[model samples]
Target chain A: MTADLFLQILVSGLLIGLIYALVAVGLTLIFGVMDIVNFAHGEFLMLGMYASFWGFALFGIDPILSMPVTAALLFGVGVLVYQVIIRRIINAPMLSQIFATFGLMILFRGLAQFFWKPDHRLVTHTLVGGNVTLGSIQFGLPQLTAAVGAVGVTAGLWYFLHRTRLGTALEATAIDREAATLMGINGQSMFALAWGIGAACAGIGGALIATFFPIFPEVGSNFILIAFVVVVLGGFGSIVGAFWAGIIVGVIEVVGGFVVGPEYKTAIVLSLLLLVLLVRPKGLMGKA
Target chain B: MTTIHLPKTVGALALLGFALLLPLVIQDPARQNFLILILMGAQLGVAWNIIGGYAGQVSLGHAVFYGIGAYTSTMLSLKLGLSPWLGMLAGGVVASAFSVAMGWPCFRLKGHYFAMATIAVAEIVQVLVTNSETLEGAVGLSLPMGNTGVAAMVFSTSKLPYYYIILGLLVVTVLASWAIERSHIGYYFRAIKDEPEAARALGVSLTRYKLVAIAVSSFFTAMGGSFYAQKEMFIDPGSVLATGVSIKIALIAILGGVGTLLGPVLGAGILITIEEYSRVLFGSTGSGTDMIIYALMIILVAVYSPAGVMGLLHELRRRIPSLRAKAEVRA
Candidate 1:
């Protein structure tokens, strides 16, 4: 491939990686704090895509403008799911947790199919229009905008976790749930918060993906697999690791796409995942 | 699961005899189709349970093994003039090898994490098959219409032979499960599933148990796929290796009771019947009603009785001693 083509792929991949990081951060955090793999993380993004679509279609709102609303709404959704369904299964066997999330994923997908009929929906970006050239290489302005938003959100989240009191408590809970409880920190509430935030992250990722990829009932399935790949490559439960790993994965996808066919990109990505696990099962940024 | 007492087992055998004779008794094509499907589902479920239930290692990519069985067997028979009987064994062995290769790296993962990884592998296989020119690209493969005879192990008009074959396969699967339950291998599988570290500490070889579980699972699953391919007289990467097929196997296994011998069959039978009824009676189009039923059954089964049908019954039987006595009396 030509240098321009390679550069173009790199830029696109970097942007996509940011979104992958954003989506997977929530999953990582959920695993970190709650010790549960929130398998339904992708459906939250699905909801975000649909929400953004309606925002554009019904009220003529831009996805950028609808982002905060989606985040807030999805936050509430995460909390609700945690309290109503997840909390009850918190202490149950591992099998219960896996099936519950799977059930939730199926239920949401069914609801969408029943309501929307599997038709794909696209929401046109009003503000972020056209493309820009950087040193003779062109990139879409919307993807750049999404990248900026993703980076901004990641920075903001990092700050929230590192700088705030609630964030420290969350970190404490994730580090040692029993110790955190002994210290008068409510681990349950902290877990709920992490899941809520993770849900919100999914919403952001969904809105960004919807800006480009059309929304469908199976869209969630697509991202969920990628999200799992990202989380696994990053670590089982590390948000910072997921952020960086997402970028690595994104770049790998671009490079791998050039090496293999586009259809085989996912397979190549997974093999890379296997490669990483083979060398280091705990992942790159796993805690020592 | 029903108790394994000899007379009770013989009585169950008599019931199975009467049930298999339904095709001869009724002879309606629709009834024949339902019975065949039930047998197919049961067989698939039993196949799936070997890994999912027995080892407690949920693999989401079993369809890869299944497709391997189907394609290998069918291709061998068509190209090499081999009997499907021999070719099916070819498929089973290939799938077993594939499962071992895939499971080795994957089984390093714990529980649901392993499940997700397997799903990724399955997706990769689907994509690979879809793009392969050797597999006829996306055009798919068609078997030269084999005549309805025991020699070809296929049928053009009659579904009767296929029904009996699948019944035989189901019986074999159950007998295999029973044998596994009593073997030292079964004890190792149970120990590894419940407490891997403890099992390892107690001198169980983790690798051997896992490989055995997955190999057996793949073999049975492969047989089911080969059977399916012959029945359809057509096969493809998309149809055989799709996510839906893998999930269906998992669903039926989960529905019937994963670890139990007869549960997989019972679950598969019920699920296939519901799907067939939806297609015929309810006139639900391709995938719509089937997917809905699948999702609902999974949710209800997971929520109400996570152990599935056999587990649910076992608990009921445990609670009501008289119920067991009555069942014994009925037997």
Candidate 2:
């Protein structure tokens, strides 16, 4: 392969990596603070795609313009889901929490199919066109936009989580929910906020992904597995870890898919995950 | 335990006799197929319950093991002229060893992480099956049925043989489950299920017992796959080892009662019946009937009774002890 083709693949990979970071960041946050691995996190991304799809078709809006509204809408839904369904089982049992999210995933996916049909919903006409050709490498406009958007959103959230009071409160709740309560902080609210914000990140990621990729009923499932691998590989609860891991994962997926047929790539990624997990169970960015 | 109280061995024999005679009584091909499917499901549920129900592993990937058994048995018998009856046993062994191979690395993570790991494992297996040149690469392998005596298990022409075969499997599975329930290993499994760290501290080896559960559970599960392959007379990776397949098997265990013996079987019977009815109604091919039935079962069981259908029955029987007493006297 020519150097230009190599540059093109790498650029595409880095662009996709940014999107992976956006999606995984929320999972990292929820895991970091709440220690709850919401198995239905992927379904939220599915809903976000549906939201963006409707936002464009019904309202005649651009994806970038509809991004915040899409994020906020899912944000509220996340808080509601947590308050109504999650709160009841927060202390019930591990299986209950696991199954509850699973059930909700089924429920949400069912709803999506019921309402939207199982067809690929996309914003084809309004797609950002034009390619940037630099040093014999072609970088598309959509790729550039998604990459920039992902990085900007990630940085903004990083600043918010690390610098803001609410961020510290979220971190405190994650550290110890009961202790945070004893310290006169509303741990419940923080959890709700964390899930809400995390969901927003998923929504934005979904919207961004839908720009270049097709959206099907089980599309989120495709990303969900890879995201899980990324999360596990990067570290269970580190945003920075998720960031780097996402990029590394994006590169590996593309490179591995190219080198060893698409079928073997999943095995490679999962085997990598298992290896990392066995060697370092605490995760890449996770504290031992 | 029933109206005619006999020796345990005799009672078991009588039940087997009844099952063997089912094809004779139910001459209708459809009913025979349903019965065979139920028996197959019952066997599978028992297999899944050993690890998922008894050990509380909640693997959403047992179908891969099942697929391994089915494919191995079919391939060896067709290619090497091995007896499928023997091939099935070998298939079971292969699956059990594979389970142990996977269990070593995966048993470290708990709950969702473990579940995802299993999912990944199954997906990788599916990919392997799909990509392998030997396996025919997605188009799948075709094996001739009923060639030389008992060499090939290709007797899907009549539902009677399948009924007997699955019935035999169901009996073996029940016996295995009963043995596990009464064994010391069963207690260690329960300990691991309810309290892992405490069990670990109290001299119980988590990995050892967990692997045992997985191996035993997978052995039967793989056998169920073989039985299914024999009955269907066609073996393919997609039919046996898909994500939906694992999810369905897990649902069967969850539906009946994960920990209790016979719960998953009961659940599987009901679930299979529902699925058959749905197929009859909706004519297969992603008909929403299965989803509707599954959703209802999940919701009702999850909300009203988290312990599942058998657990609900136990609770109801407890609440109305007079009904239990009357039943005992009637028996």
- Interface root-mean-square deviation (Å) of every model: 2.5, 2.6
Top of the candidates by lDDT = 1
| Top candidate, metric TM-score | 1
Over the stretch B15-46, how does candidate 1's per-residue lDDT look in tens digits?
68986887898688778877888888888888
- Taking all chains together, the TM-score of candidate 2 against the true structure is 0.91
Candidate 1 lDDT by residue in tens digits, A202-284: 89877776777788877887777777778878887777788888898888887788777678888888887767666677787
Candidate 1 wrongly placed segments (more than 4 Å): B1-4, B278-293, B322-331
CA displacement after TM-score superposition, residue A1 of candidate 1 (Å): 4.8
Task: Estimate, for each residue in A93-135, the C-alpha lDDT of model 2 and write its tens digit.
Answer: 5555566667677667766665677787777755675677787
True contacts kept of 2: 0.20
Residue A179 miss distance in model 1 (angstroms): 1.5
